[model samples]
Target: MKTFRLMSQIHLWLGAAFGVQVMLWLISGLAMVLIPIESIRGEHLRSDEPTPAIDWADRALPLAEIIDGQSLTVLSARTGMLADTPVWRLETPAGPVMVDAIAGQSLTPVSEALATQIALSRQIGLGEIVSVTSLDSPPREAGLSVPAWRIEFAAGETTPPTTFYINSRTGELRAVRTAAWRIYDIFWGIHIMDWSSRENFNSWWIKVTSIIAILFGLTGVYLTVHRLWMMARRRKAERLGGGGS
Candidate 1:
């Protein structure tokens, strides 16, 4: 009886204290599962648009010619795609920039017109283009820090519009943000109990809450077993009393 009372009190307080955390875990988990990962990643909406492969090893200008007289120190350089156009991506002290592989000419921070082309070439399956936004520095909301172009698609009849971030320098596809993905990201932040970064799952908040949840489960199990044991004792005593009488 004392054990039962203690278990009941612990269970009640645990629920009262950590109920919201439990609910957040449940809801966040459900939200993540309900949305298909492919859709959330905006992969389902992509067409198999074939980008130009790098074919400039022999015909293109040498690496030294590409980097000649540049002010900032070139960190890295590689042949890559800028939309359907093939180019050389160069990493520098300032930021990434592109060089025309054949011409050995600096071609980055691509203009808005080129950024739109990059978006259209990459995600041709999405909705009609509604707007284009460019920033010298990447937006805070963008998980990547590289300067990028934000291409927003028109909302569909049944679904919200999708947004794609294309790297201004290399014209690389940085991120695809669908409505489902945005919601999932929010729930993920709550699930991990990292309201600020939304990326740290090892936060102490979640750790403490997990410990509380475990204790809550153990107490509930004990209460169930204790109730069953008490009922059995009562039935056994009644049987003995009846036989004696």
Candidate 2:
């Protein structure tokens, strides 16, 4: 009985000591689960040069120039070919670009297309969520088809998430947005870090909080069991009339 009482006291004290932190953890966890931190923080609208007027040949050279210093390379170039619609395709080291086969005019700045893809992949608002991945690889078996260019690459064991689509002809970024994006953004913020995509789950703060929560729950269980056992024994004694004193 004394041991049970002691355990009860200890449990109470432990819970009281960590009560605030436990509440915070629950709130934070719920927020992490329900909202996308990315959406909550919101994304900054990037202002870039508007659409341009130029042909595929002129645009391709400059686009190649922009990616030149980078890891981009020209993979294939087929002229006078078109999609179901009249569109020309230019393959690059990074990805393929579709251009208006007939226009001889540049559709959009290469920098702008790349920039918009990068920007949309981020969570910008209080409940927004964005996912980004490099599509500089070959196609996978998923049903991912792009009119111009669709970035298809596998990150982790996850399927190739289409991060962005480009106006192959115009070099413009066209990303789809949804109402549920905010919830995903919040979840992303909770899961990821701000500065870089480094390992955030192994941090000391998370460790400490986890340990405290575990202790708190264990102590609560112990106290509840002790109380239930004591009540049962007391009832037994009453039924026995104090052991037939």
Relative to the true structure, candidate 1 reaches a TM of 0.79
How does candidate 2 fare on TM-score? 0.39
Which sections of candidate 2 miss by over 4 Å?
26-55, 58-199, 242-245
What tens-digit string does per-residue lDDT give for candidate 1 at 150-180? 8898876655688988777766777788868
lDDT of each: 0.79, 0.46
TM-scores for every predicted model: 0.79, 0.39
Model 1, global lDDT: 0.79
RMSD of 2: 12.9
The top-ranked prediction according to TM-score is: 1
lDDT of 2 by residue, 1-245 (tens): 78777777876776776676556556656766564444332222222323333355543444434334334465765543222223334566546665444543433233344434433443122122233333443132211343335433223232212333444434444542333443444444444422132236666656765676687788778878878998999999898997798
